[model samples]
Target: MSRKAYSFVRGFSAQPARDLCVDRHYLLCASTGALRLAAADRVWLLPPARAALIEAGHPVRVDLPQPATTASVLFDTAFTTPPPAPLTVFDLSPLARALLAECGQWGASEEPLTAYAETLFAALAAVTWRLAEQPSPVVLPAGRSPLLRHALRFTGERLGGEIRFEEVAAEVGLAPRSLARRFATETGMTWRATLRRMRVLRAIEELSAADTPVTTIAHRVGYTSLSAFNAAFQELTGRTPTEYRASFRP
Candidate 1:
């Protein structure tokens, strides 16, 4: 019988211009930028301090619309234990971050990689075990009503651009006002509120390890003015963008 191998890699930067398809039980830690993973049924948002696990042989499209740096590990199903959930999003602990950094340094050392991978799995499993004490993970369900789905998809595509009611409504075949009402009914937030939340989530990902200026991050996430972005960021996160970045940085 052919034996399967454990694999680890660093610095994965999958561009949004092309679809990145993978065929392994993959786990990834993104240091910067919002990482979107689209599997057959669900889409996961991978932000800093959060990680994603994808099952083996599952088709997934990994999208990072902006530049991002990440470390990933792949396990061939023939050799590794799989997560109970098909796809899982879990909080990254400080120890988990340290483990990932050490794993990155291990490079192509197969024995060390295997050791680290097994330890990583144990840590992740421990986290899952503690879910009874922790809050539920941040995740969004994919299926939605036809009009609602189209509008949300349009909003996601235009995250850094202006998301207007007129355009989204037209694309979804609903009047702008009716669409707004339905969106709130379905998602429990108004269109503008939802857009702001999405923008802030994207901003948090960019703020994770950016060497760029805050104004640039603001512009990159679609705020026209620095002040507006600051207020919005603070409102959503209870800390300004600068403060959030500082907390993450050593």
Candidate 2:
């Protein structure tokens, strides 16, 4: 019989510009770099400490701002049920990491999986589905409307510096109050909350992709005080900037 699951490692020099969909369930995590995954409703930053599980046929845009190596596994539907969410970004457990490390040696083969390999894959899938129940807070919601999209784009561009709701509203041609309502309506987050999330998301990308110092990264993402940055980062990610960056070490 054909293999029910396989794993592969891929490297990207630049971010892919298009969305991708696949027929098999996918577990994607960065082994030596970082990943940014954007789905319909949410965007995720995956460093070595986190993973994104995508259900078969779900379209997602993957961004690798830095040259990165990704170790991922693909499972045939016959081997496991669909995940609870269409796409779930969650913390990667030690067991899941160990399983992926072992399975990754196969390197995307079509040959039949041995019984031991089958069992290992099954265990990994089980752990994945369970972990999906607890999604990570390190995600930002995406916006759909044109005005909201414009506002989001502006915020992303300005994340490295201070951003105010009034500035964004004026830039997007909406009143401050009106823009706040739009943000809550479309993304289900207040303008302040969204900005905080956006800043931390950018910090995660930097933390994962470079050797920049924590204080520098904190300021780069618009925080004036290092203590304030640590509080916000830990509130969203449960890890300080230094600790989070250390996770990427081999």
Candidate 3:
């Protein structure tokens, strides 16, 4: 309908790098699988139980490693106030999910919305803003400096193996202490914490596949001990791997 608010749905089965920037506020959720969104200074792991609110005109890179069904709504700037952050990933409650599903019925129409449709969108917008108050921890901060960026890249590429701060620093041509300082300054997280966050986020990507075993996912993310993997995952996400996966189950 009119640009006040409109719904869009899509299914993605393969990995594709999509760089997106639109003039309308984007509320995106994956009803079936997971989505990885990378902005300039942050990365968010959006699971089925979560949704990300992207401010209008903010560019982001989207990645879908597994098959996923996405239900998204774009709101005209005049229709609602902006969220506090440029991008926010938050837990999606049942009511919010229902609202999104119902709104999907008005998918990307060119005509004006009926009065009833307008009311429905207004309610959905209220619920979305309220739920966005408590942001989720399934996000990682990105570094700005080239050295720090290189270090992050190195750590990400070697997530399946043991990653040491010293090793990363050496690869990036910096001392361990200096690199640690850079990480804290640029990413607002200590090197060890950043590494742990990376592993956990990567594990989430693997967990998105329904057929993958938890033990396999743990090892794939560089955890030699399943117990440690479970504890780390729970500490960051507040849910065990199995519990998180169960959220996607019908």
Which candidate number has the best lDDT?
3
Candidates 2 and 3: which is better by lDDT?
3
lDDT of 1 by residue, 1-250 (tens): 2213333544545566344445556667666665777654455667665667666666667777666666675555745566555566666666666655654543334343356556665554445434323322334434357768778778877988776879988988889889988876777678887778777777777776466889999998899999999998888667798887765543
lDDT, each prediction: 0.65, 0.85, 0.86
Over the stretch 182-221, how does candidate 3's per-residue lDDT look in tens digits?
A: 9889998898888888999888878776669999999989
TM-score of 2: 0.95
Q: List the residue pairs that clash in candidate 1.
A: none
Better of 2 and 3 by TM-score: 2
**lDDT per residue as tens, model 2, 121-150:** 999999988998999887887888888988
Number of the top-ranking candidate, with TM-score as the measure: 2
Off by over 4 Å in 2: none
Which parts of model 1 have CA positions greater than 4 angstroms off? 1-7, 17-24, 39-43, 75-84, 102-146, 156-164, 181-188, 205-210, 219-228, 234-239, 247-250
Clashes of 3: 1
TM-scores for all candidates: the values are: 0.67, 0.95, 0.94
